[model samples]
Target: MNINFNSEDAGQIVIGAFALSVPIAFSEESWHLAQTLPLGNMALVVLLSLGFIALFAYQSVFQANVMRRIGVFWLRVAIAYLLTLAVVSVVLIALDKWPMLHQPILALKRTLLIAMPASMGAIIVDSFDKE
Candidate 1:
């Protein structure tokens, strides 16, 4: 059965999935932002939600259109990783925080952490019945 996926619904699903992590991100980001701005928790949640949705949207589109072969899937994932890295790198640079992620271990860890939630969110959205 073909599903007419609305991007708007997907975004709402993403934010709803932010449940268990809200407190964690809120506490951590609040601590970080205490040194910076007002509305820190709200801002942190908004940023996290947007980032989560963007990654989900990217992965969903790629995973849907890319060839289903195992090798092709990995290649698609690698391209997504590079794109995410470039986007994140520019943001980190703009924010003036640079660390050593030159090694595969650290880089892979970072990518997987960012990717897992988005992957889960996409799965959740796609599996929902819309009759």
Candidate 2:
């Protein structure tokens, strides 16, 4: 039920998130979706993304005693999601794709859209060295 956030795991998650998020973040369709999707719809996407991340983590990172490791499991899931968000945000900013500061909601939606796939990759990568 206990898990540690080691540097190697963190590095893997960062690499995985970056590898997946960058291309999606650059997609014009993704950007347009962020701008046009209704707030409720975007919120749903965010929720769905987190749900998938948790499922993936359970299946891969915490296959045994998942319920008993609720706190650690959620912590790992949150870390993966947060890392994906950061990677997506940085990539968007680097590519000049980030929404204006006044449009924080749009930025959040964009990041969430990209974070969906990024978090999947991260969760999978996390499973690579299970012991």
Candidate 3:
């Protein structure tokens, strides 16, 4: 189960991540969560998101040979999470939802919070190609 990290794969992850991230980015609740969630809780959200990405990637992309191809497995997981964050940031910025200039950490936290579900969407969409 050596999944190649090709350009097309990258494109699909971006598309999938963006599809889910956009609506959340526009949500008032998401913005408030970013502003009010404690720093420790925000950190937990990031860690949990990465964990979900790793689990989903292992089950869908790497399958049985996950440990054998651990590098590729982690790489896919990282890409999916990073792409989710990137797409979320772009959408937030476009919507004037990102307050990076005024509050950088809040902006980042908001993106990470939204990236959780976006990454799930990305992993699921990427898995669809397997079937």
Tell me each candidate's TM-score: 0.32, 0.91, 0.94
lDDT of 2 by residue, 13-78 (tens): 899998898889879999998889898887788798899888877877777567766898899989
Per-residue accuracy of model 1 over 50-104 as CA lDDT, tens digit each = 5554445345544344344446445433443344344333333344332345544
* Predictions in order: lDDT: 0.40, 0.84, 0.85
lDDT of 3 at 71: 85
Instruction: Quote the positional error of residue 76 for candidate 2 in Å.
Output: 0.5
The TM-score of predicted model 1 comes to: 0.32
lDDT of 3 at 26: 79
Across residues 36-130, which tens digit of lDDT does each residue of candidate 3 receive?
A: 99989988998998998888877777775676678878888888888888899999999998899998998898888999899988888887776
All candidates in order of lDDT, best leading: 3, 2, 1
Model 1 weakest lDDT span, ten residues long: 19-28
The candidate with the higher lDDT, 1 or 2, is 2
Query: What does candidate 3 score on TM?
Result: 0.94
